[model samples]
Target: MSNIKIFSGSSHQDLSQKVAEHLGLELGKVVTKKFSNKETCVEIGESVRGEDVYIIQSGCGEINDNLMELLIMISACKIASASRVTAVIPCFPYARQDKKDKKSASRAPISAKLVANMLSVSGADHIITMDLHASQIQGFFDIPVDNLYAEPAVLQWIKEHVPDWKASIIVSPDAGGTERVTSITDCLNVEFALIHKVRKKANEIDRMVLVGDVKDRVAILIDDMADTCGTICHAADKLISAGANKVYAILTHGIFSGPAISRINNACFEAIVVTNSIPQEKNVKQSTKIQVIDISMFLAEAIRRTHNGESVSYLFNHVPL
Candidate 1:
């Protein structure tokens, strides 16, 4: 691990430190600051020439600045002749804009692809991220991209916390997440359900209908992320109205942007489970319904395996508990 150097940006320093500690190493020193004009400046404190360099920066608070800092750091490492540079972004930025749905009418740009291009152009040799909003976003990058899953850790949490797990039903808030919910239910040998939503306009959900039985059973909603929490809260209300004994939610990234915390606090869910893939301290502190699970150890293991040229496919199914 001597040749492996890990540096962190300002977005999520706590998570980076934990990941470094899990690998039995200290974080590499780097000076990062914003100028008077709010421009990012990065200076590597140590020589990274001929060494594997991993920059830990999640696209969360101050998203633009964090992203710019990561790109600049990658360029600096490459300029210094580092052997390789990997952007270890726990929560990728602009992941939701993975497609150009409306071309002529709105000129929708695939921002996810744009970010991928920026990273590549900025001297990133590899990418590491977890539970991307859209899995196909991996295809946007020409270089090697490791898309890790947070399901193993989430499943482990469910197994230990949820009583009578066999009686609970895994639910997908929308048709798009059916595959993700299926994966979790299959692992637990449990039944699963799906919620079909009808939208009147952009970001305005008209109604939601459940496709399976949740009556008298615990309903666990699973998704990749929750930004505004509007859909999640509405789904939880529907589950409760449908006579579900209890409602819970598990998502990889707890963006909790805008009014997400307020909505979640007033929602019917007993607990809103999420991984610390994004900095959620404020969200957790503000809401009694929020529960955060650390995924640093899992990420650390993936980094170790990747650095050692070992296969990380097994990590997809097993949590490193």
Candidate 2:
């Protein structure tokens, strides 16, 4: 562990600090600033020669700027003769754009793949990220990639925080999340439900229909990420209308962009449980119903395992606590 160096980008300094502390190390010195022309400048204060380096950066807070900073940091480490450089991205940027837009006459770009290419070209030897919007994005990277899951943490949170966990039903807010819901339900041996959402346009939901029985049961909605949160809020309302006793929304990344805070404050969800994959201090303070679950320990353990050439699959099934 002595040769393991961890540095943080400006996206989420608190989370990066926590991860470093968990590994019994201090964050490596790195200075990042803007020039007169508004271009990004990064300077690594210490040597990283022959060391295993990890750069912690999330896909939030002036996303494009954060991403460029991460790329620069990785390149800096590589150029300094670091043995290996891994990007520990808690929330991957441009993940939702995993595929092209076929409906548009002018096809939309698959920005997710482009990000992967950028990281690799920037000299990133590996990538560690959580719950990518689409798993297939792994194929876009030529380097070794690890896509960690938040399921173990989410399950532990439900058991400890939510009452009647055994009686609760896992739910998917949209058809795409059915697989995630079923995996949780299988683990808890609980019933599962699905909500089919009709989308009118981006950030707008037309209608939501509950598929399975949620009557008189606590409904827990599981999703990988939430942007404006229209889907989760609408799904919660549909569950309540279908006679669900209570509703909770659990997510890996709570982007909470646009009108998300207002929606959660006015929605039917009893509580919105999310990981600190993306910083939530502002969002949590803005809404009483929003709660954050720390995942720094998991990321730290993953970093340790990678540095030691140990298996990280244990975290996929077991809680870090």
Candidate 3:
């Protein structure tokens, strides 16, 4: 622990502070600012030479800028002779573009792969992130990547807050999240459902249909992220229409982009639970239906285990309940 140094970028300092507090250490002093030409400048306020440095920066709010800042910070730490630099990106940027889904389209770059390349080229020795949009994105990097799950925290929340949780059915907003939903249901020893979505075009959900029984039972929709809230909102509507007694959503990253707040506010969901992996916008913060779960302790424990050369696999299954 003495050789561990944690620093934060401008993206989500509050989360970084909380993580540092959990580890009983203060955040490392690093000055990050912008120049007249809109270029990012970073300077380490103290020496990190021969120390294991962890840079905390979530890929939220001004996505490109945050990515650039993280890359620069990693490069700076390496240049300063840090023993190792680990990028602790809570919300990985460009994760949705993990594949070239449209092969016929020209210039269809796998942006996630490019980001991984940038991190490696920028001198990152390790990568730690939560609930990536696509798990396969880990293969894009040659270095070690720790993909953490937020299911434990979410399951604990359900156990504490929801009455008759044992009777509730876990639901996947789309077939893509079947595995994620199944993992939760398996842990709770409950039944699960899946929603099949038809898309008219990109980002346009044409129709959604519930495949399993949710009738008169509490339904908890689980997904890795909720961007624009279209899938979540539409799935909730379908669940309710299919006779679900109540509908709720639990997403690891609440990306609430573009009309998401309005859609969420008008949805049939009882509550939209999300972790503080990405900071909520003003409208999301004000929404009464949205609930935030802090993941700082989970991340802090991972950092501790990594610094101590201990296995962090236990964190994947056990929640601090």
Candidate 4:
């Protein structure tokens, strides 16, 4: 709409610029600074009174800082009397802790829920995010939320880049990602496979088990996020052992925490493709086989549709024909 205004925080500025470019508009001016005590300080340089504003801020590096910037931006829009505020977070922070894993630890799902509540309370009317760690986390928000999939984008890339067209097999590195892997498989009209892993000891390698034949086929592994390369590396090893000709990976968020890059480099995968949902770390940039597939176009279109009150479902129907 003519009343739409888009802004970006310190986080994911490049992706934000691409989104703004797609909409044929300039990013709204906003200054985000750090205080002497290392606290986040944000200031809106323009007015958005009676306007629908979308704030693009993904929680990547310095996750807490990015989170605070998004919160403060929302608060500023509310105080400026904007008609509506939408938080366009490609990577939602604190998503991994959606459920409590230890008896001694407090429930962090509530913490994740608190983030949604904070945004709503601070005047966020809508949310846009991609490939949440757990799909059930959507229930944490009462406001209208649009959870976009990177599948359309990933599938398009695969169809273009992968060598063999008809013999590709979608793979899930672990049983937990079966649904995600199947979605891609169905879209590509390809058969799918699943790899199972068992963690025998802490900080130790995991043993992998294969559920389907991967031999002499183009194996494609799909997962929502890759924090550590442990599971994926193990899965790749098993796929190789099972006589898989070559393996490729499509991961939504490439967190690449710790020595994940090194681990992935040593694995049997031909290439590890990831989206720019999370900013690529320094270590990731140094890797040769790690490819970054930009989802900026997909994200940009979603933001434009959201601003114009257009249907986002069409964005996922098929990759622009």
Candidate 5:
């Protein structure tokens, strides 16, 4: 642990601080600023020479600037003779842009791949991120990438907090999340349902068709990310309309941009749980239904194990209590 030096980018210093606290280490010093023209600059305050350097940055608010900051920070650490530099991006930027939108008949860049390429080019020896929008983004990187799951944390929260977890039915807000719902359902030995959504336009749902039974059960919506909360808020209503006794949501990355706060506040969700992959202080304050689960333990342990050359698979199943 002494050989490790963890730094943080501006995107999510709160989460980074928690990770540092869990590891019983102080965060490394680094100054990040912008030039008059808005270019990002980074200066490492202390030497990271011959140490395992981990820079904690999330792909959230002000994403482009944060991404550039991470790239520069990683490059700086490597240039300073750090043994290895890992970018611990809690929520990966441009993850939703992994592939081209087929049937749109227009050209679009695979921005996720572009981000991966940029990371490798920026001297990141390894990558650590959670709940990628598409799993294949791991293949986009040439370096060793650890795509950690928030499943155990979610499980812990449910088992400890939800009194009627036994009466709960896991639900996917959209077809893309069916696999996530299924995995959790299998773990809890519970029934799961899926919601098929028809989109009229970007970030707009035309209609959602609920499949399977949620009647009289506590329907828990599971999703990887919720940017505008449109899908989640609508899915909660659908669950209620399908005769669900109660509706809850669990998302790994709660980007919660635009009207997400107001929608959640006005929606029918008993609660919307999200990991601290991105800071939720403001969102939680604004919406009484929002709950944040601490995932810094898993992240801190991952960093420790990686530095010690130990396995990180145990985190996939063991509930972080």
Candidate 6:
């Protein structure tokens, strides 16, 4: 660990700083600029020869720019003869296209695989990330990749923020999230419920059906990501209609792409908690019901452990009650 260096791209500079601080080191200097023609250029400011280098960049908005930055940084480090390069991505973008659900549609799992290949081909030694949209995305990488869970951080937030935990129940916004919500329920020693969503025809309203007793119980929705907040908002309305005492949600990444903020603001839930994998936009902060929890500390700790060859599995232990 004599020569461990961490560098951050423009996407999440704050998170990168937290990671550097947790490791008791200063972030390595680097300059990434875009040409007038819009091409990305990256330069390594310090020597990384024979050092273990980690680049922190989120594959969030401006995904292509951020992705290119990471790739170029890796290339720079490799050119400088770094002993190892590890890409630490908090949120993997374009991951929703992990498979081809429709005929004649090109699958973007290859896009994720291409990113992996870009890092590997550009001289990355390993990869560390968290809560991929799909688990099998790991299989696409030839190099060793470790995926961390956001549950630990989310669990802690719930314990501290949501009162009357013992009387709460976990709810999944859709069937796809049932297993994840179930895990949260088991960790908190609460019952689990799921909302069934059926997409009938194009431009038709999707019917939502509740699975378990949610009446008078605090309901917490759990999912990996929230793009538009449509699904969760609809589910929250159903839960409230079914007599739920209160409704809240915890999601890993808040892409907040389209009408996400407006929907979240007017949603039936009491509050929606999301991690700072991607920088929160201004409108998101204006909503009192939308709370942004900093996962910087969690990511920082993971970086520290990885640098010291310590076990990060402890992060997964004892989720909040």
Q: What TM-score, computed on C-alpha atoms, does each candidate reach?
A: 0.97, 0.98, 0.97, 0.93, 0.98, 0.93
Cα RMSD of predicted structure 2: 0.9
Candidate 6: residue pairs that collide: none
Task: Report the C-alpha lDDT of model 4 over 218-321, residue by residue, as the tens digit.
Answer: 88889988887888887787888888888888889888888888898788888888888877746566887888877777777887788777998887655542
* Tens digits of per-residue lDDT for model 3, 195-285: 8898876678988878899889999989999889988888888888889999889999998889889998888888899999988647566
Over 4 Å off, model 4: 102-110, 200-206, 281-284
Top candidate on lDDT is: 2
Q: How high a TM-score does candidate 1 get? A: 0.97
Per-residue error for 215 in candidate 5, Å, reads 1.2
| Candidate 3 to truth, TM | 0.97
Give each model's whole-structure lDDT.
0.92, 0.93, 0.91, 0.83, 0.92, 0.83
**CA RMSD of all predictions:** 1.2, 0.9, 1.3, 2.2, 1.0, 2.5
**Winner on TM-score (1 vs 4):** 1
**Between candidates 1 and 4, which one is better according to lDDT?**
1
Residue-by-residue lDDT tens digits, candidate 1, 1-321 = 779899999899999999999999999999998889988889999999999999999999989888999999999999999999999999999998988675345688889999999999999999989998899999999999999999898888899999978899999999999889999998999999999998776567999998999999999999999988888899999899888999999999998988899899888888999999898888888999999989898789889998999998878888875
Q: Residue 259 in model 5: shift from native, Å?
A: 0.8
